[model samples]
Target: QVFPAHGPGVKAPSLQDGQYVLQGVRALCLRANNTELVSGGSDGSLLCWDVTSGSLGRLVRTVQVWSN
Candidate 1:
C-alpha cells in the first residue's frame, strides 16, 4: 500500500474500469519537483506517473528486487 507524504493515511485508489493499475506496489517516492509519483513494485518494476497530467511519465532506470 502507498501513503501520501503528509502521512494522513494510505492512498489506495480503486481501479475503475479504464484506470491503469500500478500493481504489486511496494514503495513509493516523489519526483524531484513533487509533481510526479514513482512507485516500486514487487515485480522488480518501477513506474513514474504525472499527477496532474494523469499520464505515465517514464520507466524506472533500474529494476529492484522487493523481498516479502
Candidate 2:
C-alpha cells in the first residue's frame, strides 16, 4: 500500500495522474534518505520512483525481472 512520505500523522493531498500509482505492488523499499523508492510488482516488474519532494512520485525507470 502507498503511504504519505512524512508518515501517518500527516495527511497527503490527492493525486490526479494515473501514473502516480504503482500497480500490483508486492513489496516496496525506500533508500537514499527516502529520496528514492523502489517497488516490486507481482508481474515481475520492478519500478523505480523518485520521491524527493514527497509531493508526488515520479516514475524513474521500469525493469522486467522476469517474464513468461
Root-mean-square deviation (CA) per prediction: 7.2, 8.1
lDDT of 2 by residue, 1-68 (tens): 35555443323221333343433456789876777778665445556767865453545555666557
Model 1 residue 65 lDDT score: 53
Q: Where does model 1 exceed 4 Å of error?
A: 1-22, 62-68
Colliding residue pairs in candidate 2: none
Clashing pairs in 1: none
Worst 10 residues of 1 by lDDT: 9-18
lDDT of 1 by residue, 1-68 (tens): 24555444433332333344444566888878989999776456577989888787786665545445
Note the Cα lDDT for every prediction shown: 0.63, 0.55
